[model samples]
Target: MAFSLGPRAASAGYRLAVFDRIGSTNAEALARARAGETGPIWLVAAEQTAGHGRRQRSWISPRGNLACSVLEVIDTSPAVAATLSFAAGLALEAALRTVSLEARMRSPGSENVTFHLKWPNDVLAGGGKLAGVLLEAETVAPDRLAVVVGTGANVAAAPEGMPYPAASLRDIGIDIGAEDLFGALTDAWAEFRIVWDKGRGFGEIRRLWLERAAGVGQHVSIRSDSSTISGLFDTIDKDGCLIVVTSDGRRVAVSAGDVYFGAAASVGAT
Candidate 1:
């Protein structure tokens, strides 16, 4: 069966395209946007075969999961583009709250269940993973750009033998209908767009994000291609960089790196 959203859920101004299955919502939305697709387009799929995550990791997407992407055309700097993930994280958190999951913001630790934001865009839940966000942008016309925001939430079950710990909404005893979750996400996106257009700055979004931030003030290890650094998790910069205070008392800003907490932090640094 095809997935369709009701009018009361999403903004009436936007157009939604639903699919029974797809290779990746982000890829489809990117192709359409590059082909001159206009603003406020939502691409959704019931299952994804080749879903993507940050740093080219395979996002484990199964049937009955939520895989969707929204394409928006806006004129903004790359810095603003970078912050889109954080904004989306806030929006996703709000969507989850609507389902009454009692999903509080948490960092990776020895606790039972915790969700945290890993730098640019990954939502970690409990001892396992929950959801993630991906943002890709391209300039199609002069002063005009296309931004594709892709999101995947483990509504039913997580992939088997995952690289890291992962979780699903069902694991937490929250049974949110997939369609209802999609509606909430779209509505949240619409609200975020309004804030983005008004140039109100990222203060509000950032504040909400930090409130749910993972590993803030905890020791973390960030690994990139060339090197590794470990330090206390500080704050996310306006440009979306993960700020870490190293043991040497130097605050190093990590622009792009895989953040790992707990014992994985030591392993990631190497």
Candidate 2:
């Protein structure tokens, strides 16, 4: 199957750019935006040679994996733009469930496959990392902000020896191609992006996100560039800052951090 936009996405005037292989869909989307492309366009690749996550961390996306990015030029502040990552997570999770269920019906296997949203920007399936979302933004003009939300899912392959555990759909008995997942993703994104409403409907998005969120109310450690904070994972605030309730009863809002949970919290935590 080829990559195409869903009915809702197409009707909403979204465009698609499919690449058999590419250095990075996110990079290409950002480059197009910089070149005066004001769009709600999807850039998808069958493989990624130079894909990256937050902090420039390498993200593996060989052929048969889904490497897609969506570009939007909005008038929201950068901080508001960051909340769109939650919508991205919701979209990917929804798409995974939709495709996985179709796979299960064809060949019944493990019917216990579950998906959860990890704080900040990841989707967890059966407690292992299944997909990730990366948000990049640039101020193209005084009032125009260009944002690209990139999503990658391990459809047929998963990298080995990663710091955190990773899982692919095939590993968990879901045998589907990247194109099938991409089609679902565009549809899911359309639904959730409306809920996000260019950051205006973030309150509803936050509620929906917290509903499927993993590690909430659990002990977690957050590590940033300067220091590490260990505490209970309270909730994301109005502006999407992670609210961590410390051991000393202090509530600290973390804007960016690498999160660890349960036994892993003490590895590099304060």
Candidate 3:
């Protein structure tokens, strides 16, 4: 099927570029932004041959899924830029709710069937992987950065030969149209972009994120390099780092790591 930019971008007064297939939407958006693509451009594709996740993990991109990148210019430090992923997660949750999916910010003890945020940018559903967000920023000018927020949501089906468990919207009985879903996402993102532009930083965004956090104050394990630490989920720093209070009461700030909750009890230790 040929990819087409739907009415969402036009209604939002933004330009969009759609492709039938691409190596990666995020990479394409970054290139375009560097080449002077202005505000609010979307790069979407039906298939991504070389999609990637954080830490260079391969992302599966089937044809009938949501694979898109949103490019926006923001003036902020790298610290604040890191928080965009959390903000995007909130927007995505709101977008899912618009389609009657009962999506909310995931945190520990949510009582919503094991949904929670897997640290910086993953949304968990029913104790499995649901969706993930990736934020890539580059300095376009002094104090100015163009942020490309890439997201992949399993709308129809999840991957089969993956290491981790994955879920799709259809698995939860959500039968939303793809066009409607993308439109809702763009609307939510536009509204959140305004919040970021107003110099609110990540305070308000962080609070909303924590409300929907997947495993706040739960025993969790985070792995980085050759070391792993188990701790209670503490809080998120202003820069969007995961703060974990270890068993010894020392709060360790994890900027990057693979987080596993219930890993010790459910699955064997990592």
Candidate closest to the true structure, highest TM-score: 2
Lowest summed lDDT over 10 consecutive residues: which window, candidate 1? Answer: 102-111
Compute the lDDT of residue 32 as modeled in candidate 2: 97
- Candidate 2: tens digits of C-alpha lDDT, residues 1-270: 788888888998999998988999999999999899999999999788999998999996999989999999999899888899998999999999999888888887657588998889999885578899999999999978999999989999888998888989988878999999998999999999999998999999999999999889999999999799999999999988899999899999998989999988897575
Candidate 3: misplaced stretches above 4 Å?
Answer: 1-12, 101-115, 264-269
Which of the numbered candidates is closest to the native, going by highest lDDT?
A: 2
lDDT (CA) per prediction? 0.77, 0.91, 0.75
Better of 2 and 3 by lDDT: 2
Sorted on TM-score, highest at the top, how do the candidates line up? 2, 1, 3
Write the residue-wise lDDT of candidate 3 on 1-270 in tens digits: 344444544676767787888999999988887898756787877777888999889886777778888988877777677778887888777776665433323223323334466777887775567778898989988888888999888877888877777887767656654555677777788767666653465688888889988778788888778888788888888777889898788999889887777655234235
Clashing residue pairs in candidate 2, if any?
none
| Backbone clash tally (model 2) | 0
Per-model TM-score, in order, reads 0.89, 0.97, 0.87
- How many pairs collide in each candidate, listed in order? 5, 0, 11
lDDT of 1 by residue, 1-270 (tens): 345654643545778898877999999988898888976788998888998888788985787789999888877766677677778887787777765443232322312344566666777665667788998888888877788899999988877887677888878756666776788888887777666552355777777788888788888998888889899988987667889998889999889887888678987877
**Ordering by lDDT:** 2, 1, 3
